[model samples]
Target chain A: MQWWTLFQKELIENVRNVKWVWVPLVMILLAVMDPLTNYYLPQIIDAAGGMPDDTEIQLPEYQPADVVMMSLGQFSSMGVLVIALMSMGVISGERKSGVSELILVKPVSYLNYITAKWASLALLTLVAFSLGMLASWYYINLLFGALSFGALLQVLLFYGLWLLLIVSISIFYNTLVKTPGLVAFLTIATVMLMGLVTTIFSHILEWSPNRISTYIQQMLTTGSVPSDLTGAAIVTLMMIVFLIFGSVYTFRKKELAS
Target chain B: MALVTVEKLSKKYDSSPAVSQTSFQLTSGKCVALIGPNGAGKTTTLRMLSGLLKPTSGTIAFAGMSQNSDIRNSIGYLPQHPVFFKWMTGKEFLVYVSRLAYLSKPEALRRAKNLLERVGLAESANRRISKYSGGMKQRLGIAQAMIHQPMLLMLDEPVSSLDPIGRRDVLTLMEELKEDMTILFSTHILGDADEVSDEVLLMHEGKIIESGSMGELRQKYQTAKIKLGFDGDLRDYQEKVTALPTVIECYIQRDVLHVTVQNMTAARHDILTAASSEEWPLTSFAVNRASLEDMFMKAVNS
Candidate 1:
């Protein structure tokens, strides 16, 4: 019961701060720019370039699925950055300002606090990513060709799980870091570093959470899901669960000095 | 029966101790003051009792609870400087806190409104906490603490940061609150402890130096002393007064002569005779009563 109440508080905080509205708009903007840019690149280049008149540049024929993949890639980079910025202060700011001392002294459980934070961030991720993807899908279909909505939804779900992993890690870091800015830096650094490492060893680390990004792209471009989809997803979900529980455990023993 | 019994409670940050092995108990329906100077561990002790910070080694047994049981539901705590979500209105924050204490939504709303009225914040209930004055925010902090109607209320330096009016407002609120609930508040000001507390606990250097009712503390530390003031420097008379047989020692404290003596009756006679005979320009003279400052100093030195 208290969990539900605290979750509501989290949602209210997000809405009052306008993150619920602005974050999705940012995501939609990033997603929309992908297909629009790819569709008009050659023409835009010809207009902007002070190049010699007779030079003919060859460009590959673009596909709707490729446009979808480009937008997912945009979501992976800029989209995750936005998620990190939005949720970084969820716990650390309260601790620094002494508000956590006021709330934690009540009969509320630390698990409820962490769970509330994770649920709110997850909700934000779902709403923002869903809106952004739907817009991207519409643009890709118009600019390139008709693509399977079913496959688009599948890839979005897979990539959404990956975003869930990032949000969980961010929340876990929020408890450990002392400042919001540092939490943002650390979370983004960890995500980018993990993405680099896993991509470099893509075959050997088949079950790494970062593979979801590649798997989403592969599923869209080839019209077939990755063979390691289920295994990598199970690993990612397990990691998210572990991070949430770990955050709860750490917050329970945390000494709130402020 | 005692409402709370704490034994050998100690907390160490890194290796250095902030609160040492301190033990005390509180009976039901009593207002106790934890008194000390800066860096005296008053805040640390209160934090431990409120369960906001874990002790390195100790046992705290609240009434009807086991030694290690969670007693947070029965305790309300306000830190030295209470912080709130600036984005929340005073009423909304109170309601949210009440809900966290397990009140249903309607009940939470009812209690939040009631507490706002009780704290004299009803007029500004809808005002954002960011715009609240220091005193209003403090009153709201207390309202949130009392939202659950806990058995015990713990406040750390409730009025230390307020203006005179703000301090008076919080102190008056505390006076009214102690009538219904047991309260243990910490303060560095001895007068604040003397103002409303039924019992006073003096702490220094991370240890409890003395604990008693205000009357008992005064009686225990009472002495036969005389105070004298003159138009001239009082230090000139310190030597003359010390030479008298009944006078044990003499010192000057802010233009007043404090003469500690063996016997009040005899010392008064000898001092008065010398003042008249020597034609000293005396301004005021009287036998002195024990002050909380004097007692606190003695306790700290001892």
Candidate 2:
């Protein structure tokens, strides 16, 4: 019940700050723009008027699933950064403003406090990402061809986990730091470092949570789940659980100092 | 009826101790002022008692609780500079905090309404807290703290940041509140402490140097004195006042002659008789008692 109350405050704050509006808007714009830009690329290049008259540029044909994948690709970079930026101040900003001191003095536990934040951010990420992916799926079918709904659902479930992992990382750093900007920077840096290591040693790091993106891409195009998909998903879930517990622990120690 | 007892409560930040070996007891239904100058660890002691900051070494025992039970349910705390969710309305903020204290929604709303009215914030209850004046926000902060109906309400520097009028308003509110529950408020301003608190705990250099009822502290540090103000220069009467047999020491400070005397009655009779006989200009004559400022200075410096 206490967690529910805290969650309501968090959700209300997100609504008041227009995170509900702009976060989803940004996601939809990125998702829809991918399909729109790809469909009109040849004309866009022609309209630039920089190419010679005899130049013949042959663009590759884009399947419906490929356009969706490209949209997720945009999300992988810009969208992940947006989630980090949105959630970076969840705990640290409250502490800095001294509101956390007042709230924590009540009969509220650290676990409830941390989980309320995580749940609120996760809810926003789920709704915003679902709307973005649905809009992209609609555009993909309209501009290109028909795509299976089951494939889109699979893509959403897998990729949504990756987005939630970013949210957890952002919240974890918020508990460790005083400045929201530092939290954002640290979260982004951690995600990028994980991606870099996974890419450099793909064979050795096949069990990494970063491999969820690869499984996402494979599901989008080939309609077949990779053998390591469950392993990567489970690892990602475990990492999220660990980050949450770490957040609760760190928050208990650092709350007074902040 | 002792409400809370703290023993050997200490807090060390890094290597320096912020609060050291502070021991005190709070009886039920009294306003106790934690009095000290800045950096005297008043805020540190309040925070540890409020459960906002953990003490380095000590034990705080409430009257009816077990050793390791959560004591926060019985305490409400307001920080010196309280920052709320500026986006929340005054009413909404109170209700939100009450809910965190484990009240059901209906009970939360009911208490929020009652508190807003009690604090004279009913009209502005629907307004966003960001739009509140400093005093109004302070009233709201107090309301939120009391929403849970804690037995002990601790405020750190409650009236130090307000204008004269706002200070009076909060002081009046605090006066009304002390009738019901125990209040422990910290202040560096001696006048506020003197006017409002029943007992005072004086802290200096991380240690509580003095703690007592107002009358007891005054009696212990009282110095019998008389102040004389003349229409003309004080230096003229300064010599005459010093020559009186009852006067121990006569000094001029800010155009007034402060005469420390051996006996209050003898000094008054002697000075008045001398002034009348010599036809000296005496604009004001006051029999003075030692103020809280003097007591605070002596306690802190001692």
Candidate 3:
């Protein structure tokens, strides 16, 4: 009940917080605007060059499944931006304002405070991703033909994992840096670093035929999606653990009298 | 009955001690003033006592030990400069903190609103804290500090930024609550200290310089003070009075020659005799009592 009270406060204040709206607006623009541009790009290209003589322009086949996949994938990355933007001051802003002292002084432990923040953000992302996915599921069918719900579910799960990954990164950044500005900038920096490292390692590992990517490509190309739940379950569990435990661990050392 | 105790408390940022080996006791219903210049560990000590900063080494015990579960509900703190969520109204912020402090919803609202009224901020309580002036924000800070009605209230320079009116408003509220709560407040404003505290704990260079009631310290530290005022050419008369036996400190200010004599009864007689003999311009010669500020400066400087 007490955690709920704290969560409610964060929810109210965070939703009212200007950054929350700004970050989502930016994401919404990316979600809808990019697809619209891609849909109209061929026509724009042909009009710009005035069309070659006696040439027939072949339009790429449209699939509502494709739209959903493209939109979810791009918006999934945007999810990281939203979460990072909203959570930049998870630790440091309170420290700056000297509220850490007042808050920690209360009966509430640093654990509860950090957990409440993570839970609030998680709840927010769950709802946002759910709504965005459910909406795009229709918009994709409007532009293309019928898509499989199973495919939609897979894409949604992928988007969900991406959000979880982002939250983990945010919580980690929020934990490591106790200053808001540094936390925000460092979070973005860490994401870039992670991408760079992953890209370099992916290239290096591809030389010997990477196992993880090979399995994923096999699942995609050969329609051999793994029936076993082990990898997905483990990743989901780790994401949950990282969010709750990582936040509490980092928050413990933070002085409430910040 | 030490309501709060700090033993062997120390904090170092990298290497230098912010608060070094500091220890003190706060009894129930006793107002202890933690006085010092900036960086004198006043804030650090306050933070440690209020459980804001973890001491690099040492322990903080409330009513005996550092178990927060038992004591967390009964400690109220107003930081040196508390930062509030600007979007939250003062009342909302206070209620939120009160809820975090474990008050029930209705009780939380009641206590928060009552505190706002106590601090003379009831009308503006609905306004966002971001829109508040420095003084109003300070007042709001105090109101929230006491929302829990904690057994011990630690205020860090609570009224340092207030204008005269705001200072009086807060100091008056503090005076009223002093008998009801243990106040561990910090400030360099001797006037506020003299007005509100039962005992003063003066700090300098990370250690307490003195601790006592004003009269008690005066009785122990130095000779008595006597005010001797005489009409006409007080500077010349002050010179004569300093020359008198038993008189220690004599300074003339605008025809009032204030004299601090070692023995008041003996000095009175000598002054009367000299006035009659030398025909000095003397309308009156009386002893002026010392204020706590004088005694405080003596202890700190000593």
Candidate 4:
């Protein structure tokens, strides 16, 4: 019951701040922009008018699945950053402003507090990502061709987990830091470092959460599940659980010192 | 009856202690003031009691509660500088807090409305908290703290940041509140403590120096002195006042003659008789009772 109240407060704060509106708007724009730009690439070049008049530019016919993957590519970079920045202040800002001090004084448990935050942000991210992906899928069918609905659901499931990993990482860092900017910096840095390591050591780090994006792309295009897909998904789920527990532990120890 | 008993409650930061071996009790229906200077650990003590900070080594046991049970259910705390959800309206904020205390939605709304009216914020209940002035915010803070109707309401410097009008508003509200539940509030201003508190805990340098009822503290530190002021000069009347049989010591400080007396009643009669007979130009005469400031200074110094 206490967790429900805290979650409602978090949701209301996001709604009041219009985070619900802008985050999904940005996601939709990123998603739709991919298909629209890909479909109009030749005309865009013609409109640019910078190419030689006699030169002919040949472009490949993009597949709907490829366009969806392209949108996911945009999401993994810009969309992940957006989600990270949105959740950067979840815990740190309340501690700095002294609101946490007042709230924690009640009969609320530390686990409830941390879990409420994680659940609220997770719901927002999943909802926004789902809306963005569904919109992109619709556009992909209309512009290029029809992709299997099963593929879209699979992409949403795996890709949403990766995005949630960003939210979880952001929340964990928020509990560990007192400054929102520092939290944002640390969260983004962690994600980028993981991506770098996963790229350089793909074979050894096959179970890495960062590889979920690659497995997702493969799943969408070839309709073949990677052998390490289950491993990556399991590791990602374990990391999310560990982060939520770690956040609760850190928050209990810190106790809103400011 | 004692409602809360805290024993050896100490909080240490890294190497330095913010509160050390402090034990105190809150009597039911009494407003207790935790009085101390800045950096005296009053805030730390209140935070521990509210369960916002863990004590370094101590046990806080409330009446009728089990050893390991959560004491926060009976406590409502307002931090020294309370920051609320500025985007929330006053009524919405109170309702939110009430629900956190586990009140049902309709019950929370009813309590929120009643508290807003009680705190005199009913007219502005729908306004966003960002639009509230400092005093309005303080009142709203008090209202939220009381929404759950906890057994004890703890406020850390509830009025320290308010202007005069705001201070009076909070003080008056506290005075009314102490008639029911126990209230333990901290303040550096001795005057505010003197005005509203029934008992006082004087703290200094991370330790409680004195704790007692307000009257008990005043009597413990009482100097039994009489202050005399004159129109022209104190030198003329100082010698005469000192020669009185009941006067023990007489000294001039800041244009007033401070006369410590053996007996207050006899001293008053003797000094007034001399002033009337000698026709000395008397400006003011006051029988000095020990103020909270005097008790605080004596306790801290001792």
Candidate 5:
């Protein structure tokens, strides 16, 4: 009940700050804009490039699944960056603002506090990302042909797991670092490095948590789950669990000086 | 009668001690002031007692609870600069902290209203905390601390940041609150301690130098001296005053005679009688009593 109350406060804070409105707007804009711009790229190019007579420009046809994949790509880079920046101050901001001192001095459990934070961020991530992807799906079906809804759903489930991983990385770093700026920098840098390292070593690193990203795109493009999806999903799930516990453990020390 | 007992309580940051082996006991329903200069570890000791900071060593047993037993539910703490969610209304913030203190929602709401009224903020309960003045914020801080009706209410410099009027408002509040719960507050100003505290824990250099009731402390350290100002040559009365059996020593400086006396009652009688009989020109006579500041200076200097 206490954790629920605290979680309610977090959600109210998100509402008051307009994070609920603005974050999903940014995400949906990133998702749908990619497809709309791609569909009109030829016209945009022809207008900009005023050829003297007849100029033939060859542009590749965009499939609905491919455009959705392109939107996911934008999410992977820009969406992940936005999530990292937005959630970077989850723990550190409270500590710096001295609100944690007021609450922690009560008989509240450190684990419950951490879980409440993670759960709220997870809810926000789920809502915003789902709405953003649905908007992107609408535009893709409208401009490009209709894609498989079942495929999009499966891809969202996997990619939602991936977004969960990113949000956990953010909160986990929030617990470790005191400055929100440092938390954002470190979380995005670590996630990007994990993505880079996993791509270079995918042949050997089948179990890397970063593989969930590729699994997300692969699941979206092809209608079948990859054979290695179970191993990567398990590894990523274990990491999320570890990050939650790690957050709880590290957050215990935050009140030592606060 | 001891509500809180702390023994050898110490807290260190890195290798340097902030509160060094401090021991003290707070009697039930007594307002105990932790008085010290800046960097004297009063804040550190209060933080450890309130469970905001863990002590590097020592024990704090509240209401006879053993070490390691959680005393958070029984103690209320207001930090030196109490921080609140600026977005929350005063009543809402109180309700929120009351819930954290384990009150049910309905009970929290009731107590939130009750406390806001008690703190004289019922009219402004719906105003956001960002709009509260320094004094109002401190009052709201105290209301939140007391929402659960804890046995001990700990305030860290509750009035240190307020304007004169704000300071008076909080001090008056503290004076009324001590009737219900034990209050352990910290301040560098000895005058505030003298005004509201029944007992004082005086700290210097992170160590407790003196701890006693206000009356007992004054009795122990009170100086027996009198100041005499004369209209005539002050030297004329110095010798005559020192000759009295109660007069232990006498000296004149700047037209005033300072006399150390063995007894105030006896000295007052002898000096007045001699002045009347001898027709000595005596202008004023006053017996000096040592103040908390004097005692603090004496302790710090020693």
Candidate 6:
């Protein structure tokens, strides 16, 4: 119950957070952006009711869920943005404010402090992801065509996968450093590595799961979970591995000083 | 019973020791003040005792609990500088802090209200702490600390940021709280410690060099010198006054005279009678006792 109070307080703080306001605001904006991308984009390129491409104007064959994938791209970008800003202060602000000393004297555990952060960030990702999903279905049905329920489910699944990646990365940021600026920088660097650098790394390192999330994004857009499911499973496991190691490494040795 | 016991505690960053082999014990219903110069380990000691830092060596026992986590449950700490989330309102900050201190739902809300009111922050409870004055923030620190009614309350330089009125308000609260809990606070200011401490622990070079009840310490380091002020020039009767068998020393301050007799009780009457027989029109006379601040300064300097 005490742990829950701390968690709830973190939620309220995040909700009231000026930065927190941007989270939902941006996500909802992405929500608004999803349909806008589906609607005006084709018309803008065509100008004469037909888009100008090398061959002809086509939206690269959107799956019933491709609308969702585009929406995922929008929301994921927002997630990365919000958590990046949030990650900067994971432990740094507390050190500055001396709240660490205030909380330490309470029969509060190091686990409590770490756990509160984990819970708070996890909740933020969950709520934002859920909001994105709702927006994804509404946009696709309204702008694209008749509902493809299977594709709808696949898009929702991708939202989960993407959120898992972001949460893991954010927690890693929280533990590895003390300052918010460093946290933001680390998060951006890690994302770039996972999204882009991993492609190069994977070629040299044969068993790298680094580019797996990008592949998952590809599969979700096509409305297929993929044949083996082995690669995706391994990649998910790797994220957990990174999260466990990162969480244990930094949090275990973190000096609870204010 | 000792509410807090520190043994051979030390903290060092790189090669310099911030606090070294500091040891002390505090019991319920008593207020012990830690007085020291800046970087004398007062804040470090308080932080360690509050479970904020890991000591380089040794142990701290709080209400029979050796673990910091256990100690934290029973103690309330007011840090030297208090920072709120800035985004949170005063009520929100207290709600969060109160909950962290383990107050239940209604109880947390209730405690937050009561503590805010106690600190005279009820009107500003909805205001953001970033808008609060320095004194108001200090008051908030105290209010948040007392929300759970912790058995042991520790404050580190709490009054350093407060005005005289604010300082007086906090000291009066501490005096009122003495009946039920143990308090151990640290400060560098001599007058602050002199007013609230039942006992004083003097720290220097990261070590507790001297400690005792204020009276015990004052008498232990009694000075032979006494303050004496006369209606006329003391030099006129200096020889005669010094000739009195009971008078050991005297010094004049302004218009009042203070005489220190060799034996205060036995020679007090004789000293006065001698003055009367001499036809000296003495305006005032009293025993001059040593002050805690004087003893503290001397101990630290020595």
Give lDDT for model 5: 0.86
Q: Judging by DockQ against the true structure, name the best candidate.
A: 1
- Provide the TM-score for each candidate, comma-separated: 0.96, 0.97, 0.88, 0.95, 0.93, 0.82
**Candidate 4: where is the Cα deviation over 4 Å?**
B235-254, B273-279
User: Which scores greater on lDDT, model 3 or model 5?
Assistant: 5
Q: Assign candidate 1 its CAPRI class.
A: medium
Instruction: Please write out the lDDT profile of model 4 over residues A69-152, one tens digit for every residue.
Output: 789889988998898889988889998888877777777888988889999999999998889989998988888999888888
Residues B69-143, candidate 1, lDDT per residue (tens digit)? 778889999988899999999999999988889889899999999989989999999999999998898889899
What are the DockQ scores of the candidates, in order? 0.78, 0.74, 0.63, 0.75, 0.62, 0.53
lDDT tens readout by residue for model 2, A128-239 = 9999999999988888999999988888888898888999999899989989999999989999999999999998989788888777777767788887887888888999
Q: Which regions of candidate 1 fall more than 4 Å away from where they truly are?
A: A46-51, A222-224, B233-236, B273-280
Writing each residue's lDDT as its tens digit, candidate 5 over B42-110 gives 888888887888888998888768777778888888988888899999999988888877789999999
Native-referenced DockQ of model 2: 0.74
lDDT for B92 in candidate 5 is 90
lDDT tens readout by residue for model 3, B1-302: 77877788888878888888877777778888888777788988887776667889987888745565446678888887777888989999888888888889999988887888877888988998889888888888877777887899889999998889889888988898898899989998887887888877888777777777655766766556666666656676767778887888788666677777777689888888888998876676566566666776677788
Better of 2 and 5 by TM-score: 2
Model 1 residue B55 CA deviation in Å? 0.7
Enumerate residue pairs that collide in model 5: none
**Cα lDDT for residue A217, candidate 2:** 72
TM-score of chain A considered alone, across all candidate predictions: 0.94, 0.96, 0.78, 0.96, 0.94, 0.78
lDDT of 4 at A96: 84
Give lDDT: candidate 6, residue A107. 63
* Comparing 4 and 6 on TM-score, the stronger one: 4
Better of 1 and 6 by TM-score: 1
